[model samples]
Target: MNKQPSHASEFLWSTPDAFEETKIAAPGTNLELETGAAAGLYGAAEVGNNVQSVWDIASSPEMGAGEDIVVGQKFSIYRCDALLGQGGMGKVYLAYHTELARPCALKITSPGKLTRGDDLKVRTAEEARSAAALIHPNIVTVHALGEARGRQYIEMELVAGGSLKHLLRREGPLPTLQALRWMSAIASGMDYAHRQGILHRDIKPENILICGRGVPKLADFGLAHRIGRGEYIPRGFVCGTLPYLAPEVIQTGDHSTATDVYALGVSLYYLLTGRLPFYADSLEDFTQQILTAPCPEVRELRPEIPLNVAGLVSRLMAREASNRPSSGTEAWHLLNSVLGQLRDVQSILDEALGYDPTVSWIRCGEKYCVRVQRPDGRQQRVFIESSEHRSDEQLLLIYSVCCPAESSFYETALRMNAEFSHGGLAIREVDGAPHFVMVDTYPRGTVDSEELRKSVHEIAEHADQVEKWLTGEDRN
Candidate 1:
């Protein structure tokens, strides 16, 4: 008798709000089970998110220092120009489409048992292709799915800014408003995925990418489930990050929309506290804790977090899955309500900057300009706008002066940029003339009066310095 390979070799894999009244499943009555396991098997490796699979592959002898795929390698219609990074499931490359002349992120994986045969491979590819059918701004667009020399590949929109996991690691605990905005965005995307009959069995920070403009895009649908597909996994097997898994999933191997909600709650806790809800040294200990222990309160770790936001997290992480929000749609609305109850954007900005309303500041769309008079009787113009390409979603302040577009000015601008760390000077063409500008950016929502004042002063001071340089003044 021949033994069949298990699909074990495969794949990998936010939000807040509100005191809004909504229906939730009654504790005992909400134990419905959905088939299929993801994030793969309930072993000790399940502690993290989809990355656990990467760890497993890395430790395996098969993942030895494989031959490096150099730049300009061809894969069907796409050419691999650079290796972006590697994950548990496969290696990601920066590839270019020869036909379309566009760049894309190409994820290559063996998918183990999922690719055991021609029929299974074709079916799995079709299932993954279904992900491409999903169209939403908050979700990463899956362009195409194909196979090259038996290796499965997915072509997707390349997000340049990196992942939410990277952001949390770099900046401890996000500002309440920014975190709420991301949470709402993720919830909206998740709701859309659920409505399309897809369950994101694995929902964690690592799967949420922050785009160039600071908008969140949910990625990694390798563990996604198509509803009513009659997929099944043995009872002991499980998928999903253990820390974020709901009690029903652990006890019965059920991966449903509620489980995703539970993961969202765990992610919210992480977003506001920069820590997991539960921590343990062993799998058994972690399992017991997740199955019976209550999630720690977010306010205890970060008291500045709004009460409604914290409360929503606790409810979403409720041990009984039914007690959590029934679906992402409900969670989305709840988040909106919580956001509405918070401070208005204009008030927050004004309060943080200690602006004098009598100064007659000018507002145009998202850009705000203010005129300042220097102590030396010089007038300076300060223009602030939300960055068009923001990796951190901050507001930028610029001070500029018209200058001749000459080699000397370009050299000075480059030198200035290299010398400064806070902000840089640049020359821009306006109406065929050049303007030398000084610009600085600060995180929005959380920047206060002292910081804003300092930034304004620095911009004005730098603009003057640039003007002096252009005039050949010896002022250093």
Candidate 2:
């Protein structure tokens, strides 16, 4: 028997793992649960005192007029193979389409869950219609919508890689670069949807599905509202996961592009620090904190996070809706700018070597090389490479050729290495022959544009001088 949370809010707000045991309802049920009354009923209505042990009665086949859909169940041209997941809406099954011979996710609404004039049924249809209209690489594709045995069902693209929530649970906080990549992709997708006049009122980690290639696609448009179209919600009921809800949405029940941006920011924060910005024992305190408290600085929690990246998160999570990015377009641009600052080796090379005409660079396979012309019209080519020294340290290697290595030159090279100020001479194979090379290194993590520029210049000059001294020619 599992221990039940003391309050309904606790059960509703608990980590996703706690809800895993809660049986998945039948497919095609509306995904979003209207909070407050509905949430309390879900938490307390089923089992007497054993709240956690209570089965999800709303989605159970026993509660419905139709029989439970078991493995190998067929609905039209699709055949259900296994259970994928279950949420507030209903169960999702891994199904294969016989006509198209493709895999898809089948979501069926539990029979008897819908009553005459039930807004949930309308919203369920709207979710399918809304998602089916927008066909973007980052947004999940809805295949078809139909009814079987008095139950409504939706066929959607099967994203093999699980949700961001599952990723966070399996692997704690992600690496900074990887997290930024996923967020940037999500922002682009959201921007596209916003331009289509649709607002994803519910944006959270669980709703973002990653594919096998690691591309994240926005999903579950159950709470989506089209801009400029007045949508109605029952008074006092808010729709969205609590921790990711925006301040304005919590206070006034308004949904806008900025509200979506706020949720994306909160999701990014969760990805960077495996915890939400606000948490409390009760729903009242938690809502108050979102309404009034200042969002904690991201860097305060993870000091290594770039300052500008932290600033972007802070701007997105601003308490005032007006203080955040006006739209997904603005947020996408802001995210991309921050990505430029957290430079990789290639970006570092582009910054240091891209502008000058006197220097030319090319990438061959994984190795990068730059040819620099000395003041005397002599030319020297320097190679830059990256390698991991230990699990924690990534090293950037910069080397330039001096001359072919020879026994007679060994003693002089050793003596000249002592006289050099910046890089040292080492014998390395170059073009199937051993050559004396000038080498320098820096930790890739801490290396910057200015440092790379100085190293390249110094290494080029030293190697050119050594070549002139040993070979008496301009051979690299």
* TM-score, one value per model: 0.63, 0.65
Q: Which ranges in model 2 have alpha carbons more than 4 Å from their true place?
A: 1-65, 118-120, 345-476
lDDT of 2 by residue, 382-422 (tens): 99987756422457899998999988888877887899899
Model 1 per-residue lDDT tens digits across residues 224-267: 76777765453345655566677787676667888888888888
Q: Which 10 residues in a row give candidate 1 its minimum summed lDDT?
A: 14-23
Strongest candidate by lDDT: 2
The numbered model that scores best in TM-score is: 2
Global lDDT of each candidate: 0.62, 0.72
- True lDDT of residue 88, candidate 1: 37
